[model samples]
Target: MRLNQYIAHHTKYSRREADKLIESGRVNIEKTKATLQSVLQEGASVFIDGKRIVPKEQFTCIVYHKQKGELVSKSDERGRRVIYDSLESRFKHFVYVGRLDFASEGLLILTDSTPVAKALMESHLERTYLIKIDGEVTKEMINAMEEGLVSEDARVGGHSKSEIVAMEFAAFAYYEILKNDKKYSKLKVSITEGKNRELRRFFGVFGREVLDLRRIAYGFVNLNALPCGKKRYFTKEEYKSLHTFLKEHSTKESKKIESRH
Candidate 1:
């Protein structure tokens, strides 16, 4: 793999950030300063800013019920509130699998296995949200959303400007009109792609403002009764189940290495 990608998979940094680190001489490959275009061979050693790098043996996953106002990042220069502050001291290094915007609260997955995090984030894992919009929902609006609409503000790959890609509505998702509440409506939304401000943008297409948005579930994992701003370690069975699921879906490189005859 490319050295920057390898660093990203093994460390807390993103791939783009890893490139910057390499360019700045903060990363070393086999005790030598790494270049931005370095290619890493199997079994090659790596280090970041003099810290020895080692792949995780046993992976750990956790579900965190994030609360509003908590930033979903490892560090912030602006001194903003962050979710890492709420994690146990021993789990301070775990990477978040996906992010929930600071204003939005919901179930977030954290894991020690970078490969697993990469897989879950890059594969467009399904996420379900319970959203409250500040406007009445009409049948026409619901049908239009179900049929998918394009947003003029959507951008692809940071360069190509186009309409927002329409996501398929899950079967159980629908809008609920509240009694005596003429201005607000609640909806259960399920989406596969985790784009920036996706649910809000989806509703924006219909001219409805999102008053509140909370993720209810991710994959087979659900927040259930977990309260906001709290976290729980994954049960042994839950951990095993995730590993088994990953193993089943893993590609050749991610599987156990086998010897050739």
Candidate 2:
């Protein structure tokens, strides 16, 4: 395997991220510096940033149920509570699959194989969330979200010249009315894409403010009632289910989209 591939396969960084390490001269092949196109010498030593790393096991993949207010990061300059802080010390080397914002809570995948993480982040995967927001969630609001919304808001990654809704449409996969208090209501939504802060912005178009957001599932993996601020390795059955979801996602998305509400 190429040096970049070797690093990505062995560590948490992706192939693209591995290339950056090589470019910065932090990677070596048998004490000799390695470049992007360099391949392994059958069996040789490899060091990253002067730390020799022998190929370990298959790789570690963990699912964490994050709590609100815990940042999904290693360390924040703001010194706020972070997800890894509450996790086992061993997870210091792993990177999270995606992120749940500071105010968001629920499922997150952490792993040492970027390839696996990248596959899960692909557009075909589904992410489910339960959101509590101000005011009643009316049919019109749901329909607008399902049909998609329009805005020239570049802040949401929309092209200023294009219909904002055309950039990406987040559909509600499933939802339930948990509350209808005149001041607040709760509902769940599932979307395919992981655009930056997309959900909060999408709902903002209809004058809804998401007060609390908790992700419950991602494709085949679910929080499964796991306690908050805890992490664990996936089970054999869970791994198989996630792998199956990745394999079938392309075909599944089409059907899922057509049948979505």
TM-score list, all predictions: 0.67, 0.70
Evaluated against the true structure, the overall lDDT of model 1 is 0.73
Query: Per-residue lDDT for 106 in model 1?
Result: 89
Candidate RMSDs in order: 7.2, 7.7
Which window of 10 residues has the lowest lDDT sum in candidate 2? 154-163
For candidate 2, write residues 151-235 as lDDT tens digits: 5542432223434453355565555677877699987777777776677776666677788888998877788879987777898
Clash counts for the predictions, in order: 0, 0
Query: What is each predicted model's overall lDDT from 0 to 1?
Result: 0.73, 0.75
- TM-score result, candidate 1: 0.67
Task: List model 1 lDDT by residue over 70-185, tens digit each.
Answer: 99998789999899888878778787987888778989999877778877787545688888887778776667556655555433222134454554333233344442145788
Model 2 vs. true fold: TM: 0.70
**76, model 1: CA deviation in Å?**
2.0
